[model samples]
Each structure stands twice: as structure tokens, then as C-alpha cells.
Target chain A: MEKKDTFIKAIQENERLIFKVASFYTDSKDDRDDLVQDIIYNLWKSFDTFQQRSSFSTWMYRVAMNVAILHLKQRKRKVPAVPIDLGALNFAETGFDGNEEKLQVLRKLMNDLNLFDKGILMLYLEDKSHTEIAEIIGISKSNVGTKLSRIKQKLRQQVNNQNQKTAWN
Target chain B: MELDELKSNWENSNNRPANQNSLTAKMIDQMIQTKYDAKLNKIRYPEIGGGLVCAIAIVFIACNFNQLDTAVTRSTGAIAILLLILLPILSFLSLSKLNFESAVSESHVQVLQQFAIDRLRFQRYQKMNVTLCYLLMVAIIILLPKFFYGKDLVINKAFWTFAFSFGYIFLLVFSRLMSRYYGRSLNQAEELIREIKETTANS
Candidate 1:
């Protein structure tokens, strides 16, 4: 009973994070719902193993991400279902302002990323630190740095080529 | 906007709700109750059930094989016992490869690596199952009449001819249909593996 309450409380607190992770893997609402259920179930099942050694959010992120990976294996999809929240990103930052079109472009490019890189991008967008991302992704912190740069460069190149195509049209 | 520009915006933005779905207590209870593991793989329970039936037949044959009179009938009974043992082992091997819950705590890389191994093992188990099922069926056909009515169907020429023709066709069709159905799972696994390889290749 106590166990259930704590687990449920943790899930409620991080449900949005779970949804974002689920969206990265599952496109449809039904699939997302199923994936969420599986994640929660697995979390509850493995809750006993979860210790206070790490931050609860970091541990939860690892479990959520892995569940999504395992979920995709059960029912493979050609295109991962990403329900990008347009309102999720703020466009009023310094340097150059980003608009909805840019968010759409980033979202479209994300569709082309592999599960690992897509996961990195999602983590990056969430502003998770290099250490946290590495811990969650099971890669070294330096590897996370390398991969982020590679992914960003790749995204930039793809966006450029896409913009060129758009201009041509 | 440049990727760097977008990064700034995303970094500067406050935490917004990513999914509109709320985590209601009712929803939590429903999720906890949804035991869809049995539902996900349509083949798992059927395979287990088949294995149990084979196990019963195995015990029955072990006890009764000595009571048969002829050498040929006794040899057939021995062979049937062997097949019954093999049948369940193969099916269980295949089913065990798909235990998603067991790998939940494994890291992402470990999970993928394990999945790759499991998928290969699964296909191998499936092949073994499909091949040995023919023998299992034949053994069951030969042994059932002996155990139940003290008769041998293999000795009857007409029955052998008709049974071979019809059973061969039926098993062929059944195996083909099942292979196609189960192949969806294999294909889905392969698709994820291939995409992962392709995307990771860029990095």
C-alpha cells in the first residue's frame, strides 16, 4: 500500500516526461497510451530495485527511455510517432529568434533520426545536462558531447538542404 | 532559423506540458490491471499449452510403450516419446526469447544487444519447432490408436495413403499460415534493428 502510493506519486510527478519519451517512440495516441501503461507497469515492477543512490528524475528518465525502446521492439513502426508540442519550445531567445517554421523543420528532421540520436535530441531539448543525458543514455559524458555535436551538425546540414529545396520550390 | 538559434529558444523556454493526457488515479489503476503481456504475443500461451499437452503424452508413452506387443509398434512408441519431449522444448525456447519484462532493467545498449541475440534465438527455435512438428504429428497419429484402441494406423495401407496425402497438405498450409503470422514479429524486430544501425551509422 505504501509502496503503491510512493510509486504512483513518482509517476504522477513525472508523467509529462513519460509522455514526451513515449511520443519519441510511438506516434499514435493508442500506441502512446499502451507504451505509457507498459512504462508505468515496468516502473512499478522494478520499483523495488530503484534506490536513492541517484536522483529520482534521472533514474526515472533511464527507465522511461528504455521502456520506449523495448516498446518499439514489440510493435515496430516505419516512422516513429512524434507529437511535437509546438508550444513546448520558447522562440524568444537571444541571437536569432526561432519561429514555428523552424520548430516544424526540427520536428521533421527528428523524424529521420535513429532512436539513439532522437533520444539525445529530446534530452538536449529538455535541457538535461551532459552528465544526466549520458547517465540516462548509458553513454559516457564525453560520448554524449560528441554525439550531440554530431547530431546538431547533421540536423543543421539537413535543415540547410531542406531550406534550399524549399527556396527552389 | 539556425539550429543554434532554436537551441537558445528551447533552452530559454519555461517547462510546458508535453502531453495533454493527465495521470488520473483511475487511469493508473486501469494500467496496473491491464495484463496485456498474454495479449501481445498471440503465440505464447498456445505454445505453452501445446507443450503441456506434449508433456502429458510424453509421460503416457513412457508408461505404456512397454505394453505394446510388436517390435515395430514399440519402436514407433519410443519415437513418439522422443518427439513429444522435443516439441515442448522447442516451443518453450521460442517463447522464452520474448520476455520483455526480464530485460527492463538492462541499459539501452544492453537491451538492443540482447534483443538481437534473442531474435536470432527465437527464429532458430521457430525453425526447430516447424521442422519437428511434422514428426510430432506423425508420432501422435501412430501412437493414439495403439494407446486408446490397441490398433496401429501405420499398418493400414489405405489409411496411411490418405493420411499422408491429407495430413501433408494440411500441415503445409498450417505451417505456412503460422510462419507468415509469426513473421510479423520477426519483421518488426528487424526493422528496428536496421533503422538503429542506419541512424547510428551517421554518428
Candidate 2:
């Protein structure tokens, strides 16, 4: 009972992170809900084995990312869904509200990244440090730095291309 | 919007999409219960069916033990009892080793690795189990003649030939199906593991 209470408390604290993961992986509300539920169940099931080697949120991200990726992989066989790549989006200098168009663009960008990169990007978006991202995804800190640089470059290129198109018009 | 500007909006966007629904403990519990019931259904039907078959076989053999009063018959009954205990234990061990539930807590790569290892172990266990069953069947066939050593047991050659042919064909097909099933699963696991390795590997 005590353990269950602890697990619930941890989840309550980090519910937003769980929601972020589910939203990143899935497009539809139904899918997102299912992903969140699945992640929670998994967290509950393995609550005992979580020895706090890392922070609970970090561990939760690890678990959530795994479940989401696997779920996406399996679902891919049945329905075709776009991968989002944030690198390709043109963020307005004055960012748009979390409007429908912005959300759609964000979703598409998320779809384009592979699972590992997706994990890194999710952490990056959350303002997590390179070291923390590396620790969560089991990658080296240097690699995380390199990947983030490359990703930023990609985003820059996309933004430049969009600018060129607007100038031409 | 600039990436940095997007970050501010993201943080200010109330943590998620506007329509995002809040989840409660009750809702989560319901979802967990649904998943648990589904998993239970997956294991329950096959396991219970297998258990029932084994129970019936053991009971039938025990009831007929007195009718066939021979050292060979007694040994056959002993073998039946052994199988009644051994086969289920083997099945249970194989099933228990698979941690589908725990995969949720592991990282993607770690889960794939663990699942691949568990699957390979299970496939090997299943193959050994099939071989043991075939050997036991052959042993029973060979020992039946011994049970009829002092008595005159009439058997038709044609019936024996047909029975052996049918049994062999069935065993061959069953073995092939099992091989194919395990082979496909192993391939999938291997591919997933390789993909994860590649994704995480430093360039």
C-alpha cells in the first residue's frame, strides 16, 4: 500500500512529462490517452525495481519513451502516420499561440525524428541539460551535444529555406 | 517563429495542447484493470486448456493401471505421473521467464535486449520440450510389446503402418509450424535490437 501511494505521488508530480511523451508519440487523442495509460501501468508494475538510480522523472521518461516507441512501431504496421521533424518548422520571430496550425506543425516535426533523437529533442524542449538528456537516454554527453548541434542546424536550414520562398513570392 | 521563441511559447502553453484531458487515479486504475484482464485472458485460456488435458490423461492412465498388470504397465504409469508433473512445470517456467509486463518500465533498447534474450531462451526450451515428448512417445511404443510379453497381443500390420505414418506426418507438420512461429519472432527481435543499436551508436 505504501509503495502504491509513493508511485501515485510520483506520477502526480510528473504527469505533465507523461502527457508530453504521449503527445509526442501519438497524433490522436485516443492514441495519446492509451499511451499514457500504458505508461502508468508499466510504471506501476515495475515500481519495485525502480531503485532511484536516477531521478523518478528521468526514469519515467525512459519508460515512457520505450513504451511510446514500441507502440508506434507496432501501430505503423496497421496505419500510416507521419513522423514529425521540428528541424523543418519555421518558428515565427514572434511565436504563434499554441494554435491549431502551430500544433500541427509541431506534431509533424516530432514525427520526423527517430526514437532516439525524439527522446533527445523532448528533453531539449523541456530545457533539460545535455548531461540529463544523455543520462536518461543512455547516450554519452558528447554525443548529445553533437546531435543537438546537428538538429539546430537542420532547423536553421529549414527556416532559411522558408525565408527564401517568402522573399521569392 | 524562432526556435528560442518557440521554447517560450511551449513553456507558456500550459504544459500541453489545449484540449488535453486530465487523468485521475480512478481512470488510470480502470485502464490498468483492462490491460490486466486482457493479459490474463491471453495466459488463462491456453494454460487452463493444457492443464485440463494433462489432468484427464493422468486420470485415465491411473484408472487403467490395474487392468494392465505388468512391470511395463507399472513403469508406464510412473512415466505418466512424471509427465503430469514435469511437462506443466516446464511450461510454467517458460511462461514465467517472459516479462511482457515489465517491458514498459525498461528503456527501449534495454527492453528489446531483454525480450530477445527471453525469447531465445523460450524457443530453445520449447524445442527441447518437443524433442522430449517425441522420445517419450517412442519409448511408450517400444515398451508396449514388453507389456504383452506373456500374453498373446494381436495387432494388425496394416493398422500399425497407417497409425505410424499418420503420427509421423502430424509430428512433422507440428514441428514445422512451431519452428516457423519462433523463427519469425526471433527475426523481429533481432531487427529491433539492431535498429536500436544503430540509432544510439555514436557516428
Candidate 3:
């Protein structure tokens, strides 16, 4: 009973990992939440095999990423019932009222990225080191460094372009 | 903006889903239930429905061999017999090569997705083979009468042979057209698999 309680408590504590990882992969709010649930469910199912080779968080992240990627692949097969408008999430009604413009621009840029780029960018944004990012992304540290350098340059150019277009307006 | 600023903006933003609501809880619950059920279904029946259909087809063909003409019957019987003997052997070979538990291990879903894509390609090839074989059989059936009736046949054997050949050619063209139509979807599925593999591998 104590072990079960501890496991459940750990899950509840680390639940935010699911949301963050899921949001990185999925654009739609519903799909993001669904992906999070799938990740958690997978973690629970595989809980018995959770060896102490790595920290629980590391294990959880691995499971979360696997589920998110798989879910994204499955999602491609179905047509969306309603098109998601990234702009709509920026409105006051959606709880993003304070920094709507910045959030909207960032969301647009993130949405433009392919899945692998998005995963790397998300981890980078979360302040993970290149080494840690490589572990999370299963890439070499040098590869992560090069990719991040290019990604940063691309993002800077995009922001500049957006600013210039705004100035013209 | 600087990279740090952009990263900060994303991190500090409140655009993320609110975690504390009944609706959110219910949605998460549903997702968990659905994933659990899917996992159960996968474990209970790892083989896809295509394998089951192939098994049934072998049984049906075996039971209907007498209905076909002697030459076709003999050729098909030989082929069917070969397939029946080969299927289990091939399946066992592949199964032996598979590391089933490792393929589905928490760290290796991407590998499993690749396997699924390969299976889909094999299924598509099978469908194309069946289509081509059927078209050929239809042509053979139409032309066989011409050879038997010999000069007494109202229509010339060569004429009917050419006609059947033209029809067969048209069927082949049609099959290609249909395959192209379905090919777009298969391409999309393949792309999804590639995306999953690349993402997981990179991560």
C-alpha cells in the first residue's frame, strides 16, 4: 500500500512533464491533453519495469516522448473536425491575454517547425544544457549544439522579418 | 529578439492548458482508458487483420480447387500449396528474428512503428500481386475458348485473342491508375512513420 501511494504521488508530482512534452508535440489543446494522458497511462503500465538505472524523471521523459511521437503519427491519418486557429488561443478568453502578441508570434514559429526541431527547441527553451538536450533527444551533444545554433539564427531572422513587416504596417 | 528572450517568452507564457478543471480531468481519464485498451488489443492480437485474411483465403481456395479448369487448377493448386507451406515457415522465421519485448520496450516504440510501416508496404505489394494475377486469369479465360473451337469458331482466334489482350492491357492500366490513387495515402502513412522515427531517433 505504501509503495502504491508513493508511486501515485510521484506521478501526480511529475504530471507537468506530460503536459509540457505533449504541448511541444501537438498544436491542438485537446490533442496535447490526450497525448499527456497516453504518456501517463503508458508510464503506469510500464511502472513495474522502472529500474533504478536512471532517475524516475528520466524514465518518465523517455516514455512521454515515445507516446507523443506515436500519437502524432496516428493523428496524421485522421482529418481534423475543426481547424485549429493558433490566433484564437491568444485572445483574452483563452487565458493568454497578457502577452498575447508575443505568445502568438512564438506559437506561429513553433508551429512551423517539424517534429524533431520542435522537440529540440522545446527542451532548449526549458533551459536544458546541450548535454541534457542530447540525452532527451537521443542525439550527439555536438549535433544538438549545431542544430541549436542554426535554429536560433533562423528564429532571429523570423523575428526580424516580423518586426519589419509590422513597421511597414 | 534574442534567443534568450524568445525562450523566456515561451517558458513564461500562460498559453499552456490549464491543469485544474473537471473537463481536463475527464479528458485525461478518457485518453488513459483509450490508450490502455489499445495496448491490450495490441498484446492480445499482435498480428494485423491482413494475416487473418490470408489464412482464410488459403482455406477458401483449398476448398474450391475443383471448380477451376485443369491447367489453372493445377497451377493454382501448386502455388497455393507452396504458399500454405511457406506462410507458417516464413512467419516463424520472422518471429524468431523479432525481439518482441524489446520492440515494444518503452524506449523503442519508434522501432515498432517502422515495423508497422514495413508491414503496410508488404500488404500493398500483396494487393498489387493479387490484382495483376486476377487480370491475367480473366484474359486467359476469355482466350481459352478461341483455341478449342479452332477454324469452326465464329470469331477468329487471333481476333478474340487480340481483343482479350487489349482488355487485359486496359485492366492493367486501370490497376495502375487505382494503385496510384491509393499510393498517395500510402505515401502519407510512410511519411508519418518517417516523422516518428526521425523525431524519436533524434530525441
**Against the true two-chain complex, what DockQ does each candidate achieve?**
0.19, 0.17, 0.24
In the range A29-123, model 1's lDDT, one tens digit per residue, is 56766676778778877888787777888877878877887776666421222233222222111111335555455557877766667777878
| Candidate 1 lDDT by residue in tens digits, B1-203 | 45566566555443334344356655665566553443443455566788788888788888987667787778878888887787777776665644566667666655665665677677868777777777767767877888899877777999889988999898889889878977876765676577456534544
Model 1 chain A: ten consecutive residues of lowest lDDT:
A87-96
Number of the top-ranking candidate, with DockQ as the measure: 3
Q: What is residue B168's positional error in candidate 2, in angstroms?
A: 38
lDDT score, candidate 1, position B95: 52
CAPRI docking class of candidate 3: acceptable
TM-score of chain A of each: 0.81, 0.79, 0.77
What is the number of backbone collisions in each predicted candidate, taken in the order shown?
1, 12, 3
Off by over 4 Å in 1: A1-10, A44-55, A70-118, A121-130, A145-169, B1-21, B25-48, B59-73, B97-106, B138-203
For residues B145-165, what per-residue lDDT tens digits would candidate 3 score against the true structure? 433432222245776577678
RMSD of each: 8.9, 11.0, 8.1
- How should the candidates be ordered by lDDT, best one leading? 1, 2, 3
- Model 2 sits at an interface RMSD, in angstroms, of 8.0
Which digits, one per residue and each the tens of the lDDT, describe model 2 over residues A5-120? Answer: 66776776777788778777776655666666667777787778778888888888888887776565444322222222211222122224547567655655555544455667
